[model samples]
Target: MSSSSRASPVKWGIVVIIVSLAAYYAVYVLPRGELGQAEQWRVLQAVEYDHRASSVTAEPKLLQNAAGSDLSALGLPTGQKTSPFTWILLNSDSGDDYGPIKMLPQGQSFTISCREIDDVSAKVVIEPAVSAYLKSHCVR
Candidate 1:
């Protein structure tokens, strides 16, 4: 093959790789990373839970994005709310049987002993407002 033919393949390969990466970032990374998109996902996934809800639990950290800024800290309605119930609703994967959150002592780590079936779970101490919200909304 001529030198230009060899270089043509290499250039095309670079173009394909660049396009693939850009498409991945636009379709996957952008939606998951942006605040508005993340919030939308959170909302769509949300299910109500109350004290009576099964297998629910809360933790001090945002389980979805442990290292990222939490909603509560960001000053959103759900932010800073003790929302183990909401967390449970949000965090459960498809096919995971989730239950109500077990209450925790203030500032203590939360746990999910309430789960009647196998699941990956954790806990966090929730604020009163979060608990109240769950209690009120989860029942309906």
Candidate 2:
């Protein structure tokens, strides 16, 4: 075969490989990425009261005491640096988009540790304080 004719086969092979990769990404990787991202968001974020305050504010905050609804604290072992509890301040359930969040350990109370940012909520991890709080409260 002539030199040009030989090159045509190589070019066609490259095109085929690229097309196959693209197809695989669309078929397998796309849906999984979407689902995994949403689930990851749920696990990392805990939908908070402030974001959805409109409903509560209109009713002047339902002043009800949880006399019997609190979870009976599970018996956690001693000397545990981290508790079974995880603190994640989730966005509102109106399906607000949370871009990406990363947990960074900071020495502060759990409430103040999380610094909310525009589309990024990565400021989630708190240090020894978080472990202490987790040992006490089971509130998600």
Candidate 3:
């Protein structure tokens, strides 16, 4: 066969290899499930809490009240700050079993106890406004 004819087979082989690899990733690797979904959520919460605590110490005026204090005394209308980081807590579980806690600064670190509410759902509370930022930037 001529060199040009041999090149066609090589190109076709490369195409097949690329297609097979794409199929393997899409069918096997991608669907195996998020390996660190739970861990990732925990880390996100911890980071947000830590950031909030630090922010409170750095800028005392930002944190108005403790988380679980009187909501009325808490800052209202949720003003946006100049900080690049923010945190938010998302209730993935159903029902309103837990008490509503006061809003903390984006820098406070807190220990969150996990409680069962329902099957296939749970709450992942991130401090400040990280959830919004993540949703906007991370999600496609």
- Top candidate when judged by lDDT against the true structure: 1
Local distance difference test, per candidate?
A: 0.35, 0.32, 0.34
Model 1 worst lDDT run, 10 consecutive residues: 71-80
- Off-target runs (Cα >4 Å) in candidate 2 are 1-7, 34-46, 49-140
Put the candidates in lDDT order, highest first.
1, 3, 2
The per-prediction CA RMSD against the true structure, in angstroms, equals 13.5, 14.8, 14.9
lDDT of 2 by residue, 1-140 (tens): 78865768779999999999999998777545655355434333332222222221111111111112211111111222342222232221222223222221222233222112211223223233333444353322
Q: Which candidate gets the maximum TM-score versus the true structure?
A: 1
Model 3 regions more than 4 Å off: 1-6, 26-47, 50-140
Cα lDDT tens digits for candidate 1, 6-92: 768778899999999999988776654444254433443332222213333232223433223242211112222344332332331
Error of 2 at 17 (Å): 1.7
Compose the digit string of candidate 3's lDDT tens values, residues 1-140.
78765668778899999999999888766543353133333444554454533332221122222243211111111233433234333322211112122232444332211221111022224332433333343312
Report the poorest 10 consecutive residues by lDDT, candidate 2: 58-67
Q: How many clashes (backbone N, Cα, C below 3 Å) per candidate?
A: 18, 5, 16
In model 3, the worst 10-residue window by lDDT is 112-121
lDDT of 1 at 105: 20
